[model samples]
Target chain A: MSGQLTLYTYWRSSAAYRVRIGLALKGLEYASEPVHLVQDGGQQHAAAFAALNPQELVPVLRHGDQVLRQSLAILEYIDETWPKPALLPADAGGRARVRALAQAIACDVHPLNNLRVLQYLERELDVAAPAREAWVRHWIGSGLDAVEKLLAGDPGTGAFCHGDAPGLADCVLVPQLYNARRFGLDLAGWPVIARIDAACAALPAFAAAVPEAQPDGPRS
Target chain B: MSGQLTLYTYWRSSAAYRVRIGLALKGLEYASEPVHLVQDGGQQHAAAFAALNPQELVPVLRHGDQVLRQSLAILEYIDETWPKPALLPADAGGRARVRALAQAIACDVHPLNNLRVLQYLERELDVAAPAREAWVRHWIGSGLDAVEKLLAGDPGTGAFCHGDAPGLADCVLVPQLYNARRFGLDLAGWPVIARIDAACAALPAFAAAVPEAQPDGPRS
Candidate 1:
């Protein structure tokens, strides 16, 4: 809202998708500078993009002079900078719970199955396609199962991951579930998450942030 | 600190060690309930422990009746609940930078090299020792190399990761560097990080929170 906001993102990157949802949810407009992850040995690794984010990862949000990386961190920054329609819960305990739920997927599940890791498994470790697929599903399934348990029993759960409003956890969760489906994992196993996803999908913010809706997406 | 604070942690868990440093930094007293990750087929998976954290992860901090999982989230929780020595910076941009730096290791490098993931790489994929070791080094080296870039180029980085104070990023970085050494990854390559680690190591708080100093650690 304050500066020339630009996001270096990829269509299929779950991390990037998470940030996209955060921006959409905040009703913030930004320029998308798509960095193709798979084309030509990863455009993310290119000197220019790498200069922006030395991690050579996507979802690098540039707000004027400020360069931000890591999806969850960016989400938090967005929430903090534009305090209207807060992404996290009001109470400290609730914020902790939402952050935990988001990290359950972001740190634990998403990192293990990202593009570079999968590439390493294939090219470096010589893991076959089916095995790689299984590896992806294995982590996603277990991680989601844990998340389901976290949601199922907690009295705090409502229409979304926190209360009725979709916040940080929902932003992180929707993209992860999208990635899970992309890798051929079923959502039927986690009814709570499935319902949450349905709720998130009903929102135009979440709808506009999907991979297929991105400028660089295949369908686009 | 009100109510009983009990941490269900594993000795060698990098995640748990992070929370320990956070608690120590805050001068908060807590009971350490060590859950052996390797022994007894990982006590984390035990029914009772699993009930506490359905994620079956360590560093599950129970403050009163509130159970918190995920190290970074727990660290933020500690910061918010007891805002004595802030783990994050006061300014939004600074907080974003610190969180991004912390997450660069937590979400990107650490998860790829953690116990369960390594086990999957070996037991499931049959990746041999040398290859697994290489895999660990690859992630750590690249991650730290990027971290080095993150620290070196930024004027914001001081004696510690952010402005001479050992805050959130330092807590995450030190344990990661420790794990890097455990896997035979040298820290000499990242001078900025190595120097910061040295600075952090000199603190009694960080020293007391080390894995070797824990009740379940080897020395203890």
Candidate 2:
């Protein structure tokens, strides 16, 4: 945890945003190497970035010599390496619940509405822009609805997705909500998720990791 | 590990297949509650299953009173609950590597080509059969290609994805390879993955988890 760390990040990428929140929460400092997924046919597709992650994806963490891809895996690695302010709950069952919430977004939701997938729908499938936007909103709505049920229905829920603390699930939820808002989805229906998102945004760790705060963030 | 365990699984679900492999690896027994994803507008959509998992997805693990959703989370829970014959490595870096390899399939590849996504392509977008097949193969090919490099390039990979014994990555790999073959993609191109798949297939733990071996397997 003491060595030099570098993060390959994109300002608006939800997966990258999850990692950013994780690093900040752990109080770990790392140099940022921005990989634009859009500019010039995606800098992630460049030979140099591809060498780092053959998947040609962002949010690649370089911890010393070991390069780790996959946002959830990287989050776990961080949690294991630096156990303080643990990202996951101590018990196995609690950990499973938290992870299920995270995957509810990362696997079940975000993958469907990813930029690359959207691009494929547009380029290969010839989906119109409105249709593509609808696709994004549809998945986000259903995904967040499931998440809201998980969060609201469980007695374990406190101020966050798991316990009172903002943990792994919160890390994923904040970013997904951010993306949802960008698509003009009204989140008033998901009162629990909205509450958690608001709470997370108040914290410096989550606040600093917002898409607009990154070095490569969009200029307003 | 010695209590009533129920798995709501679809016969050919890769995600459920991954969990079945994990359960078998840990030598735990469970009752199979087949939730046919296709029959009668998908049993996963029924009210009972929805109460278990709002995501409306297969591979819901019911251990006593606790209902666990998401395959990767279930795998880790099983590993944590039963330490012997551990699925993840002891070391932090090794665990990260194994998790990354697993996510390379679970997240990067499988979600894209899942039945829900494919059905969306066909029903919602009116994507033709051949184009849909191309989409599936494209993801599987690209995904497995990344896995092959990660395994073959690293010394950490032994007979299995991580070590001499089959672990988490192998659990994910075997099922994905099975799905890929069902799609008629040649495994010959990924010699490393092919070799590991063969090794995993030889194990009774992995062999018992094959889609065809399940009680709910295809009638033919």
User: What's the residue-level lDDT of B6 in candidate 1?
Assistant: 97
Candidate 2 CAPRI level: high
Colliding pairs, model 2: none
Candidate 1 Cα deviation (angstroms), residue B169: 0.4
Report lDDT (CA) for all predictions. 0.93, 0.91
Candidate 1, B60: how far from true, in Å? 0.5
- For A1-220, candidate 2 gives per-residue lDDT tens digits of 5678999999999999999999999999999999999999999999988888888888899999889989999999999999989999998889999999999899888988888889888998899999899888888998999999998889889999998999999999999999999999988999999988899989999988989999999877
- What is candidate 2's DockQ? 0.83
RMSD of each: 1.0, 1.1
Q: Which ten residues in a row have the lowest lDDT in candidate 2 chain A?
A: A50-59
**Stretches of candidate 2 exceeding 4 Å from the true structure:** none
For candidate 1, list the clashing residue pairs, or say none.
none
- Per-residue lDDT tens digits of candidate 2, residues B1-220? 5558999998799999999999999999899999999998999999989999999998999888888999999999999988889999899999999998998888889999988889888888899999999889988998888888888889999999998988999989899999999999999999999899888888999889988888999766
TM-score of the B chain in model 2?
A: 0.98
